[model samples]
Target: MTTRVIAVGGADAAAARLAACLGGTVCPLAQRRFPDGEHYLRVLGAVEGADVVLVAHLHPVDPLLVDIVFLADALRELGARQVGLVVPYLAYMRQDRRFQPGEAVTSVSFARLLSRSVDWLATVDPHLHRHAALSAIYSVPALAVPSAPAIARWIRAEVPDAVVVGPDEESGQWVDEVARLAGCPGITGRKLRHGDRSVEITWPALQPWRGRPAVLVDDIVSSGQTLVTALQGLGAQGLQAAACVVVHGLFEQDAAQRLQAAGASRLVVCNTLPQPGLPLIDVLGDLAEAAARLIAPRQG
Candidate 1:
């Protein structure tokens, strides 16, 4: 029972790395749009009777969702035995619940849509909130890969005399874990959001870490406003040097620039997504191991 790794658009490099790790072949998927704005997807290799792993990072969620559906259905139609997903950055996770009346739970709906196509799912550090785990919404066997160990290792190797800081209270757990692993002090700040791009961040007492480098860690940096606010607050506190570390760097538009402008000394992200300019820490080894386990038969 051989498993083949297929890379969807924008996921080619990570998929190739995963294929090498899994000792599987890389299958290419091509996409095109019709004149009226419909999508056409084609799997360029034979998948007949083979276990297939579709690697995609669900940023730019709408089009990628359609692509995954079309590709998975196509593979099944071509007689593929099992189809699994390796989504490094699982989107639609933020909308786990409705904030107002008459609103849809998009997370559950997205999970159902994905569950219909894949036998099992694997992703790196999904933005899980208001739910304990992926199993809450996704019926399929879902694995949430932790990038903390990897991030900690990167911090240890790169940042010296670093004090780990979480941008908001919600990130305290990850910050504490990473700091423990890196053998550094950890502190979390308070965040109040007014709108999509408006955020207020108040840092905790950093008297103990004054003059030491601050490493701000978080799961996702979508709009980067949170980080910008945090960095500005730190600078006002006389913390001159700061680094931003994240699992997913969905730096929308000039987000990276904004963070830099706000005085972030360095920006590092895991290779979960295709971050072209910033430094990337490899997470493919972890993802490949998870994918391999998903394809393996369970021992009862």
Candidate 2:
């Protein structure tokens, strides 16, 4: 079965790598911005009557989402049998629910929108806080492809003597998985949320990590506030680490510099966002491999 690869704007390098690995025809979609600030997307090649896999990663106000929906609808109209969405990093996931009055649960709404538009959905390390199962949250078949194993392999090769540490209790599960793969001990911090919904992070259990090369692991690093707080807390306890490893490196508002100033020796992340000052570990290979396995010819 022949597959056609369509990569929308973000993470072009990673997308290209995945397309090369899949041996699929790469169709580069051009993104243009109107003088009035609107967006334009153009599919460069023929997509009629083909199985199209749309690859893109969501950044702050990502234009890729708009393009994905358009591409999916166009492909279907042009005779596409199936449309597969492979988003390395899913945005608006943090707003999965609305606590206050009159707010949009962008995650669910976005999931529904994408579900109706495509046949299958795949993403990595989505900000799933309270969802018992992601499949239950989406009307379509949703899969969470973790980058922990890949991150672990890279950390093991680079920082051989590092311990995995979760910046907060929320990151415990991922830390455990990464620790297991990296063959290192792991620790999760205790967190206290204030009335303002601000967090007071503490790693009281990090006493044993005082002199070890520790690695802080998490799914997202938005403002770097959490990491800065964690690193300061670690310092207060005289706990020091080797580096930090994050899955989705948003690095908003100079978060990377903030983490460094807070004492992160090194920052390692997958090539999901085109942020500055970090190594781009290609995650598309893992994503494409998983997609290939999942969409493989159904056995009789």
Candidate 3:
């Protein structure tokens, strides 16, 4: 069977890389918004009877979700045999449950929406809080690709005498894993978020590694407050801010500036989103591998 990779808008580079890895053709998607605020999308190539891999990063989830559904339905309508999704940064995953009464479980709801659109799904380092895995929420075959190995490799190669630090207790596991792979010491701090832009961070005892370069690792850096707070705390403890590593760098508003102001020496992120300026650690290989497994013929 012929496998074709489709790069949705904003995911062209990632899709191209995946296509090269799979040795498949790249299908382009033409998208635009109507004057009335409606979206219009069209697959620019033939997909009849072909296995389609839709490469997208559902970051600003709203319009992208619409685009995804439209694309998937169009492919199925055009007689595509299978549809698989490779979402590098799956959004709306942070809201796993309802904190307030009458609040919606958006994680499950979003999972259901995507599951209905494609046969299988793959994502990189989704913000999996409260849920153990993506499969716990998604009804379809869902795979969460870890960025720790790649991040660790980058850290090992770039940062000397690196001491991995997790911004909060929630990131302890990921921080420990990266440290283990990089063969460095790891510690996690405490974080208290009062609002979107307001946060407080308390670092653990860093007296042992005071002069060592500290790399703060987190799954996502949305508002960048946590990272800013951590960077400030690290500076106060006499540790040099080597770098801030994140899987999904949703560096909103003044995030980049504030990080630098707080004494972050460098900022690195996985290529989950289209970040132009910062260094992007490639995760396309990992995404393609996972997608290949899903689209491969089932063993007897």
Candidate 4:
């Protein structure tokens, strides 16, 4: 089926790339804020009887979530048969479980809200810390596409003397996979989380991979505390100023400046999130592949 791809907010560029991949038409959308700061959205192209894919970069999430639901509903009201979402960097997965009393589990809630709003969903390597997969929280046909292969390829082509270093134990397996694919050795560090911005990392002995250039790898780089600490730890071991590779680059506030000051030689991230002046590793192929698979012809 020929699908119609519509992007909300700052996802027009990504939507264009995915549309090219899916062999879909890029549907025009008009969105703006009112005097009182309320969102307004309208689908300019016809979507009747067509499969519509909503492309969204859900960082700075709350407002986009609101806009997307409205836009999805608009598509349905305009006679669209199905609505799917392609959120490159999905948000709210961090709060999968409630550690404190009376805290809201936004992961499940966000999934519920999104599942009801769209028919199917696809995202690039969502943070699945507690739940095993997207099926655990989302009721719709949703999937997380892996970016390891793409990352590995980038590392092989770019960083010749790369030694993959995972900042924390949570990323041990992930780091190993990337390193194996990149044909480089990998090591993981232990982390004791004091808070969101505060973390204590225990670096493993650096004797084995001492002279090689380090590349700190992780799925997400929000606030960049973990990365900052990792750079310092690696530098202390005489491993030279290391580079950073991340899937989602949510460098909030002064995080980017901080990472630079912390001695990160290079900061590379996937095109999952739109940011200015940052080198992007293309993951649209993976996203398009997964999204196309999910929306493929379903036989009765």
Candidate 5:
């Protein structure tokens, strides 16, 4: 069975490229928003016995979810052999557990909803806190691919004289991995997060690496407070403005602008979600390999 790659929302180009990489065909998805903010979707083409991979980035979570859920069901009804999902940046992963009384563990709940829909799922650098892996919550075969290699390659090629810096101790392992892969020294700081917007971070021993520029690495940036805090600290020490590299650039509202104002010389994110005008580090190779692995069983 040939694999058919289809995109939801604005991922059409990425889907076509992925289809080309897999030596498959591109199946377009028809989507429209009704006056009342409801979703109207149609999966175009004839896939009587073809395997389909639906590519979607769950950034604007709610509405896109409606499209994904409906399209997945339609694929099954239309006689597709199997349906696979590639969610570049998954939403609702921040609250994996309940901290206080009567709170929803959205991460697990979202996982349940998706597990029932798609045959297999994959994402790039999911903010996996508490849960060991995606398989812990998802009933289907779920893969969480790493974007460290891509980030490292970018640093090596673009910023040759750089020392990787993680904003907090929680990110120590991740920072070290990227640093090791980039062939540079890495250091992680300690962070005391008061709330989502308010945070306090202790500087790592950045003085030793003062000669080289700093590259701030983060998995996902929403409010940009942590990175701003890190930047402020770096500025106080008279260090060069850091180059910010993130796996997922979930900069809400004017967060991206705010980050640039906060002394970020360059801001770059993985091609997980499209950020117009900003430079994107490609993770298409990683995504294609992970997606191919998911649909391999059906072809076999």
Candidate 6:
């Protein structure tokens, strides 16, 4: 029996690449939107008695979580023996804890729901803090894939004398990994928030980038607030703006436009999350390799 891979809809190019690497079939699934803005999804491929992998990114799409759950149930009903959930950008992971009294921890709740829906889960650069673990939250076989190699390769190809900047302390780990791979200098700046929801990112003084390019590396870009602020800060120091790289491109409405307006020269993000008209560097090769490693032992 051969393993099968399918994408639930959004961008098909990356999915097709991943399936090609995995020696799997890229089956079809259909989605119909009604007048009321409701989405109807149907899986058109036969997953019965097969090992199935569903590749999707939970970003800029309505009813993604609900749709994945539907597919899980439908696949089970169709006699699929195993299901792997590969969501490049996992949603609701920032809400892993309750911020205040009577607040619901949506991250853990979503994890629990996903755990029950699929047999194994894989995600890239999840916003997991100190209190949470991917496997612990999902209560299943979980894998955390980092985009350091991909981001590093992109930096080497694009930026000149780029200093990898981590906007906040939390991002230092990933920034360090990417910087090491790129053979570039890296720094983690101090960040403080006045309110529970806002932050100020401070950049350090760098002499090598006096007239050179610099890249900002981070896991997620939401609302483009932090990045815009960082770019402004970097420009204040007279450093030439190069590019911005992120794993999850959760750009809010006009976020890309706003960032470009705020003086960011180029924005680069992986196909993990679709960003229309942006410079997309696909990471399907990394993910396909990861899946191959995970399935190797099981297949043996």
lDDT of 2 at 106: 82
In the range 1-300, model 1's lDDT, one tens digit per residue, is 767888886788888888898888898777889999999888888899788999887878798888889888999999898999999889988887889998889999999999998999999988887889999999999999989899899889988578899989888878999999999888899999999999898877778777888899999998999999988888778675558998899999999999988888899999888888889988889988998898886311
Task: Work out how many backbone clashes candidate 1 has.
Answer: 0
lDDT string, candidate 2, 209-264, tens digits: 67777788888888877877787777777667578788899887678898899898
Q: Which candidate's lDDT is highest?
A: 4
lDDT winner, 3 or 4: 4
Poorest 10 consecutive residues by lDDT, candidate 1: 291-300
TM-score, cand. 1 vs. native: 0.96
| Per-residue lDDT of candidate 5, residues 43-147 (tens digit) | 778887999998887888888888888988999999999999988898899898899999999999999999989999988988887888898899999888898
Off by over 4 Å in 4: 298-300
Least accurate stretch of 10 residues (summed lDDT) in model 6? 194-203
Instruction: Assess candidate 5 and give its TM-score to the true structure.
Output: 0.96
lDDT of 1 at 215: 92
Screening candidate 5 with a backbone cut-off below 3 angstroms (N, C-alpha, C), the clashing residue pairs are none
Clash tally, candidates in order: 0, 0, 0, 0, 0, 0
Angstrom error at residue 10, model 3: 2.1
The TM-scores, one per candidate, come to 0.96, 0.91, 0.97, 0.96, 0.96, 0.91
Quick one: RMSD of model 6?
A: 2.3
Question: What is the overall TM-score of model 2 with all chains considered together?
Answer: 0.91
C-alpha RMSD between model 3 and the true structure: 1.3
Lowest-scoring 10 consecutive residues by lDDT in candidate 5? 203-212
